[model samples]
Target: MMKITVALLFGGKSTEHEVSLQSAKNIINAIDKEKYELTLIGIDKRGQWFLCDQEDFLINGDSPKDIMLKHKGLAVAFQMGKDSEQLICFAEKTFTKSIDVVFPILHGTYGEDGTVQGLLTLANIPFVGPSPLGSGIGMDKDVAKRLLRDAGIPVAKSLTYHQWEQPGINFEAVVEQLGLPVFVKPASLGSSVGISKVKQQDELFAAIKEAFAFDHKIIIEECIEGQEIECAILGNEIPIASAVGAIIPQQEFYSYAAKYIDDQGAAIQIPADIPKEIAALVQELAIKAFQVLCCEGMARVDFFLTKEHNVLINEINTIPGFTKISMYPKLWGISGISYTDLIDRLIQLALERNIKDKSIRKSY
Candidate 1:
């Protein structure tokens, strides 16, 4: 068996850069060493790519280093050959390699917002996760909600605003419709970054302004008075939805600090303590939403279930956080797929997608 040269792309010019690095470290540990010749490619928060030797996190006692170590930093660019049979990466003065497939273990902004996917698409290289179109739509919360609602999926009622748009115009109008106690989020961010819960009118404007700090587009959603649920979806043609899991956040809502920094901040309730019918519905909606948005490799669908048992699709994460403790992996683990196996399956799906994509002719 030939070993594939897999480039594990991690970190980026996004607020989730640290989270991405953490995910990449876990992924580097899980991939089967015999099948893949893995290379660690780290993109700094400034968007510069570096070829690193120490992909694993350095630990001394309980303290971990702030960033991964780099042995060599390369300024690299990819170009498609005339034949289209191979893709080339040119790095600085004297380094080049053919990428068999790109396992982009990246999250948010340039990494997950389809910018990197588009570049890989142009080079015709096989990469993991959803395609550029799917990723782009998934990153934009407003567009994702619209598509999910169109597909008969229930989504929380919300209003979207861009940072440049004038404020103080009809704040009451939106509040009156959706009511107080809403979720303010940056439309294109992930990992619970730049998300806030606004309960009073006085904090509404400030919440929106803070959300716009991360992304130009912001979504304000009516807070559902129920449980927070998440479902993991995987595959290409016929995707599989994992068992649903419930989140019990220590804070009022799942915040960045609660999600990562604090260990006792949340508890994962596997198979979600919901009725069987609701579990079935969550799985069904997970698959439907995955298909609705053209997600291929993988995604984690989050929802808000009200006291009345109303299931509102919250959002879809194309490149979800994948540490051993993340909901995406934990939910799937409860569904019987081990972490190592899930990583292997995602790589296989990437190869299969590459074969399928190459079958189409760009120039007739």
Candidate 2:
């Protein structure tokens, strides 16, 4: 059998660029070499796209841009249309390569926030993770919370504001409404970048300012004191939710450092110590959130298990981390799916979506 051509897209122009690099490295190592022909595409911090060398993918000692420039990596571009769509990789204004599948390992902002998803959709490319609609809403905490609440999923109390409203924002009113110990973060970005746990009234203004620096919109939510439970869901139409896992953070919360940088940041408890009923509830709720949000391929639904045993939906990651130590694969691993097989599963889901979507009529 001929090997499928896989384009592993990574290193996006997002706050989590470094995180994406690490994720792509892990994914590249896990993918079966015999089944797929891999093409590494790296999008640098400045938004420059390059066809990276496979050997250089895991080498974080050098910047992607510098490595790309030195290795004469191809510059990539997308041409849109039903038939005219193509991923054109140009090197020295001559070389070009055809792409079959795109595994966008990009996280946060332009990556997970629907920008790249929209681009891929228009180009008629089969890519992993959620559709543009799902990605757009899922990336924004404010919008997602509203939608979740409307869907009958319990969410924490929160307020959304734009940077322009900073001058008029009544910090005292915000504190009074959400109470102390509020979490401030950019509404759209992920990987815990520009997130702050505001415990005092004095920290409100600064936290909001810091969050707004990451995105124009910001969300301030009441910090729930509870166990952080995460459930990984895989598949397209019929998503399979893995056993619920819990996070015990050594830090104040699961920040970027805790997630990617620090080694002893968090303790993962797979098949969490929670009651069996709660575990089943988490899986059910996760599947519901995935379907309601139009998520395809896979998603990781996070929740807050309150002291009172209430399950409050935190947020859904349409494209959760795939790094060796990432919860998505780790949870599924404990649930009996190997890392390599999990990658194959997502690729299959992406192809299934492509087939189903292609069947739809473009015109009456």
The most accurate candidate by lDDT is: 2
Please, what are the lDDT tens digits per residue for candidate 2 over residues 286-352? 9999888888888899999999999999898987987655899999999999999999989988988
- Which has the greatest TM-score? 2
Give candidate 2's whole-model lDDT: 0.85
Off by over 4 Å in 2: 61-72, 82-85
lDDT of 1 by residue, 1-364 (tens): 9998888888788887777777887787788889888867778766777666653333231222254434355655566643243433345555567678888978889989899999888777888999999999999999999998889989999888877774653678878888888888899998788898888878878877789888888888888898999999999999999999999998888877666556678888998999999999999999999999989999999998999999989889999997646888898888999888998889899989989987888796
Candidate 1 residue pairs in clash (backbone atoms < 3 Å)? none
**What TM-score would each prediction reach against the true structure?**
0.93, 0.95
RMSD of 2: 2.5
RMSD, each candidate, Å? Answer: 2.3, 2.5
Q: After superposition, how far is residue 29 of candidate 1 from its true place, in Å?
A: 0.9
Model 1, position 197: C-alpha lDDT score: 88
Q: Give lDDT for model 1.
A: 0.83
Whole-model lDDT values for every prediction: 0.83, 0.85
